[model samples]
Target chain A: MLQIENVYKTFNPGTINEKKALRGINLTLNPGDFVTVIGGNGAGKSTLLNMITGVYSVDSGKIIIDGVDVTKMPDYKRAKYFGRVFQDPMMGTAADMQIEENLALALRRGKKPTLRPGITAKERIRFKELLSMLDLGLEDRLTSKVGLLSGGQRQAITLLMATLENPKLLMLDEHTAALDPQTAAKVLSITDKLVTSGNITTLMITHNMRDAIHYGNRLIMMNNGEIVFDVSGEEKKSLTVDGLIKKFSETSKGMLSDRTLLSD
Target chain B: MIEFIQSLPSPIAQGMIWGLMAIGVYITYKILDFADLTVDGSLGTGGAVLVVLTTQFNVNIYLALVAAFAAGCLAGFVTGILHTKFGIPAILSGILTQLALYSINLGIMSGRANTTISWRNYKLIVSSKTDELFFTILKLIVIVGAIIAVLYWFFGTEIGRSIRATGCNQNMSRANGINTDTTKIIGLVISNGIVAVSGGLLSQFSGSADVNMGRGAIVIGLAAVIIGEVVFGKLFNNFVLRLMSVVFGGIIYYIVIALVLKLGLNSNNLKLFSAAFVAVFLAIPYWKTKMAVKQPASKDKKTVSQKEVKGNAAN
Candidate 1:
């Protein structure tokens, strides 16, 4: 479970470009809760995730993950409690490192790095099994550097890496945003499969309104640095994309623009 | 040609000593992707520490060498702090450390510009003072081989892999819970430590450690690394062999210098020649890639093929 209590964040305060990124934001997730987050640009969806992952400092209030207070922990230190995938595929995996090596790094997340051999034979066998599940023909290429893979393949490997050790919480910040439509759909299916099977508590931020409704047991909507809508269970299942868009317009000053990048 | 052949032995010996420094350079340049200039200062710091300890304090020569490595580590540590903690740029941090080391090296030698240690008096490791060229080269070869073996093993360890990950992609490393800042400092420490060891050996080889001994040391290290990549990069993909290639590059570089000197080139222009040599080799890969990608609209396949070739190199 994860908890954010009345957290607030401001960027470059007092400057002309200063912006309030988060405002008295408070949200909590139960164990195995799959929460889909939807918001337009500057809606603070990504900012909230970053705060939980410790990428952004919580200006006020606290972040508690699984009973551990991590409000002040740095990003790398807080990594032990969570697995994260970024919007940019390149940001989630080391290109020059071998596939197995990247997996090994993820496997040891939150653990102390030691003088022992990084990838033993036993770990390699497990890595192969895990890679084979992705069905990307990456199992046989365990030793191959990740840079050779396409963006979609890299993102798949990154997803595998995040779930390698069954992290306390999984956070995805528009992880499929950079992929083509087909690849994005494929990745989304894999994500759905992983989260459902693993029963992972997740916070997934998406620009696609349909996806926000299609996936996850619970859904939250954000606008102007605050959560304005929340729904779950039967109610969340019944909500359609058009209904949600109309709801967003009623509660907020602006409309939820179409998911296309060309939209204002 | 006979004269050049006769002069080969000394340059070969010089090359082996310089080769160790090149391996250290490889750690920072090729592995960490950090162009650490700390080697420039750490080399002198190593030489100064060794010479001062051996001659003034009557410390054991081998112990003095260890001290030299620690001294180099300290210099690298300072640079790492400047870069990571103080928010200085990588190149500037190295430059600052190298500049500060000038004063530190002078202080280590008790304000003396140069200090001499005689093989005749002290039990030196390997030296030019002796006429036993074959044994000296043999000893240095073993040392170089041992260093390479050690490095190969170290890089296979968990901590070492984390360091490599940090260099390749900092975001991924941090996300995976590796302390990139700590790994970076550790890398700088190891690199400068090895460079210092070579500096100490160089001082012992020539029977003297001078304040100016490490001048343009980075360029020479880079030259050796670039030469290694240009010559043996394709031939040897294994980590251990790649390190050996760096040493061989140093030898080949020295051999070329010997030949160039024989062909009526003045020693005064040696630095210029080295600079020019490094510049050309460094540009070759960039130029080759540029040409490969500079095709017309009809040559999409050519570009893909070139990219695949480059990708294959990653393995």
Candidate 2:
């Protein structure tokens, strides 16, 4: 459902800060493929996702989503095809807007906003029902400003927003890294339930090794702007954190520091 | 005190007119989260267009007001294009447009710095010289009320909500598939249009449109917005009521100015006073945040700091 061909991205070329973020990377995903990506810092994992979402243009590559080449598409345009959750909880929702208003905006993704009422009476009822499902008591605070919510609640709302329109691809970029462990687990479980029920195609980037192994049908390890390992099916299911770490150290030429790769 | 009381009506009328411009500023400043400097020039553009159409082309007063509003929109459009399409910073883009409009406004008035329209010869809508103060007040109230009503409805619409979202959180807006560039441009357009209309009304009421009438307009508008929020923000949380409060803020601002003038302050120092007034109010929130940060031992300090961080991100 998504294809990346010979994608190359270099930041600050010809300068002291020059760095090749991606180099001739190519990957393709089949329908309903759930991939978990793991890497150390500066592994180009986020860059790859940013390129796919058109947040940053690839220097030389084509991104095709659902058979349409969207390499040149702007971030907002590509947004219609992808549901994205950012690393920062605050990045995913407008703080000043009400809870229902944010949901209404998500529900209208890929549709043109018009002069009609922003939040309708019927939509409010639907929103309340959806919020209740999160069990966060947000249903009672439909008109409460999103800024008043905690980090975990905001991230949860963001997850709901991402799935509201049943996007073609769901992208999670360390979405729970900022939350406490308990809150992270709750959000991750919510993520699992939504993706499983909807059969949504997803690409999740996680720093935690257990989470990397605990979720998804496939797992890929990236290092130095290249995918070093790709494991799926029974192989991915049987893999343990220790084995994965051994493999990463070997493949990455022992560049995988214990602090960087093994930290949760 | 009696002199101040007698002078109250004139400033009140003028305040209502300036309140229209303040409302326009509120859209960009508060709603769009844009520090648009376009109002300083667009206000003059409105008055110039109105004066040129009414005096030179003999257009109907209402038509002149409409033309002035359109002219202001055009000015804002230029700033929006420069900011969004050319990738200029919004403040720089507004400054560029404001500079350009100065020359355009001059040309519109046929190279004249000031133009006067006689109430005796022209069918004026509202004027300070008119003996019927009741009629003038009623007319100003109706105009401001109609504008507030329209704006209240517009902000509740889908497009309006998107614009608000763009201001509140641009990253979230884009991820939700909103064309933030388009929304921002529309906001500037709407804001400048309303500012121009207020300029038109001011020109009519004061009997003349001066080239420099818009100088420091942004400061005055900000003062009104800050003052309104400071005074009535807690009580007036509803959107429409908040807008009404802005109008009242403008009136209070003018009344304060009138009182100071009555107390024998030099008129030339009014701009300085306005600048100082806005500066103090703008600093209040910052000071509060600083105080919050200082209380590091407090349990709720973390929440306050988080809010501060969020506010920074929104900007």
Candidate 3:
């Protein structure tokens, strides 16, 4: 479970470009809760994720992850508790490393990293089994450099690596936006399967409204640095893309915009 | 040819001395993804510190070397802090540190532009053998052995992998809970610390420390790193090979330069030669890829190749 209480983040305070990214925002997720977050550009969705991951300090607030207060922790310290998949697939993994090597690194998170005789047989076997689960045939290419993988394949590997240890929280920030539609769809299916099977507590930020409804047990909408709509259970079950767009316009004081609705 | 063969051991020793600095450069340049130029200044600064502490202050010679390492670490820390905390570019941060050390080094040398070892100063190699070359070779073996062993041990620890991971992908490193900024600082500190120690050794080897002795050191270090990487990259993926390759690169560089000098090449053109060597080593892969691309269009399979040759050369 994770809790964000009275969180505030302001960038470049007192400067000409000053922007209050998060304004007293509060949200909480119970264990195994898969929450999809939807917002337009600059709606403070990514900023909220960055704050949780400790990329930027909150102006004022506390972030509690699985009973551990992580508001003041540095990014690296917070990483052990959460797995993240970035928008750009390349950003999620080290390109110069082999497929197995990247997995080894992920496996060693929060532990002392050492270089011995390279990858041991036991580690290789475990890595192969994990890679096999992706069903991407990556098991056969353990020595292949990650740079040689396609964006979709790399993201799949990244997703597996992120979830290999089953961290307290899994954060996906438009993880498939860069892929072709078919590849994105495949990755999303993999994402759906992984999260549901592990029952991992996940916060997925997506630009697609349909995807917001398609995946996750709950959904939240944001506008102007605050959560304007938080729907779940039966309320979320009956929600449609049209109904959500209409609500955005009625409660958020703005049209949903063609791109926002079309993106769904 | 006999005389050339006789002079080979000295070059080997010089190579080992330069190898220490080159490995330091490799840490920052290859691993940390930083363009740190602090080696140019910190090397001389470290040498000056070692010389003054040992000769003037009458400090223990071994302790002076440790002091030199600490000074280098401090210099690298300054550069790292400037870049990470103040948002300065890595290159500019290094330049700033290098510029600041010029005066510090001079101050260490008692305002003299250079300092020569006094008669009573402890020598690093104290054999009574009349052959300077034999003594130098003996010193080289000891120093190189010490360097390789220490580096191998240091980089084998958990912290070393973290430093390497930080270099490979800083963002991922942070996401994985490695404080990339701290790692960057540590990597540079370790790197420059070794560089400074090498300078300390070099001062003893030359029996003098000049304020400007560290000029073009970055280029030379880079030359050694790239050449070692290119030549011996295929031998092994272990960190040990990486270190050995750096030493070999330095040796090759010195030998080539010596040969050039023997062929009536001007010493002043050393920088140009160094630059050219780095460019060629760096360009080897691109040229190979270009050649591969230009291959007859019959196959038209322009997929990204999984060739080690392609990747290593590109790097």
Candidate 4:
């Protein structure tokens, strides 16, 4: 479970570029809650995720994960409780390291690294099995540098890494946006399977309206640093893309074009 | 030609000693992806510590070397703290540490710019004054070999892998809960420690530790790394073999310098030559990417170009 209380974040305060990224935002997620977030550009969706992950400190707020207040924690320390996938495919893995090495690092998340062997013989076998499950032929290339992998393959591997230690909260920030449509679909399916099987609490940000509606048990629409709509259960399941667009237009008063949301 | 041949042994010995320094540079430059300028001062710190301990304190030669290594580690620790804790840029942090070490090295030499230890009175490990060139060469080789072996093993460990990951992708490392700042500091410490050891060895071989001994140490180390990668990179794919290539690169660099000196070039111009050599080699990959972009035929080529640009931006 995760809780955000009265979170406020402002970038470049008192300057020409001053902008309030988040303003008094509050949200909570129950155990095993799968939430999809949708918003136009600059909706503070990514900022909200960043706040939770401690990538950016909230100006005035508290972030509690699993009953521990981590608002003051550094990004790396906060990472112990969360599995995160970035929008950039290249951001989630060390390119020069081997496939198995990346996985081994992921397995040691929230644990101290010691002088032990980086990847043991037994761990290698387990990693090969895990890679084979992705069906990307990465099992055969355990020692191959991660930079050589395709974007889709890297995202899939990143997804696996996020769940390797079974995180308290899984955060996906447009993780599949960089891939082609077919590749994106494949990675999204992998994401669905992993999140469901592990019963992980997830907060996913997506720009595509169809995907926003297609996945997750609950959906929230954000605009101008605030959540404008929250729908769940049967209401979320029965919602259509057109209806969501109509609701967004009415709520934001046509400040953003529907073309941005309708492109997908 | 006979003169060049006769002088080959000395250059080879000096090269082997500097090869150790080059290996240290390789850790920060290639592995940690940091252009740490701390080596220029730390190398002198090593020699100063060794000379002070051996000549003034009358410590054992081996103990002097150990003291020198520890001194180098301390120097690197200062730089690491400056960069990580104080939020200074990596290059500036190194420069600041290097500037501080200059005075420290002088103080270690009892307010002198140079210190000499006589081989006749002191039990020396390796020296150019000794007539046994073969033995000196053999001893230096053994030391370099041991260092390379230790480093090869260290880089394969879990902590070492994390350091490598920290260099390659700080974002990924942090997401995986790695304290990247700690890893960077550790890397600088290890690198500077090795560099100091090399400096200590050089001071012993040359019979004195001069204040300006490490004036362009970073350049020579980089030259060795770049030259090694250019010549033997394709042939040596294994980690151990790659380290060896760096040693060989140092030897080759010294041999070339010796040849040029024998051909009547001034020894003072060696630094200029070294700087030019490293500049050219470092530009090769960038030039290759530019050429690839000009071809504009393959999607993979574009990707490589973009990746190179990204890498440049990151650096």
Off by over 4 Å in 1: A255-264, B296-315
| Candidate 4 residue lDDT tens string, A1-264 | 898999999999999999988889989999999999998888899999999998898899899998999999999988899899998999999999899999999998878889888889998999899888888888999999999999889999999899888899999999977777777889899899989999999999998888989999999999889999999999999999889988998889987674566566
Give the runs in model 3 whose Cα sits over 4 Å from its true position: A8-20, A60-62, A67-69, A108-125, A140-144, A242-254, A258-261, B1-6, B53-67, B118-123, B126-135, B138-142, B234-237, B276-315
lDDT of 3 by residue, A1-264 (tens): 899999999899999999988999999999999999988788899999999989899989899988988888878878898899999999988887778777877877776455563346798999898788888899999989899999999999989888989989999998977776667788999999999888899999987888899899999998879999999998898999889888888766865563643454
* Residue-by-residue lDDT tens digits, candidate 2, A1-264: 999999999999999999988988989988888899998899899999989988898899899999999999999988999899999999999999999999999988878999999989999998888889898888999999999999999999999999987899999998988776777889999999889889999999988889989999999999989988998999999999899999989988977674657765
DockQ of 4: 0.57
Q: Give the Cα lDDT of each candidate.
A: 0.89, 0.90, 0.84, 0.90
Q: Tell me the tens digit of each residue's lDDT in model 1 across B105-148.
A: 99999999999998878988888854777777988998888889
- Model 1 chain B worst lDDT run, 10 consecutive residues: B306-315
* Winner by lDDT between candidate 4 and candidate 2: 2
TM-score-sorted candidate list, best first: 2, 4, 1, 3
DockQ scores of the candidates: 0.48, 0.57, 0.34, 0.57
lDDT by residue (B1-315, candidate 4, tens digit) is: 887788789888888888889999999999999999999999999999998898888899999999999999999999999999999999999999999989989999989998997788788878887486688899888888888888877888888998999999999999999999999999999999999999999998888998889999999999888889999999998888888888888999999998888788897888888888789999998998888767755787778678656533332
State candidate 3's TM-score: 0.85
Q: What TM-score should be assigned to candidate 4?
A: 0.96
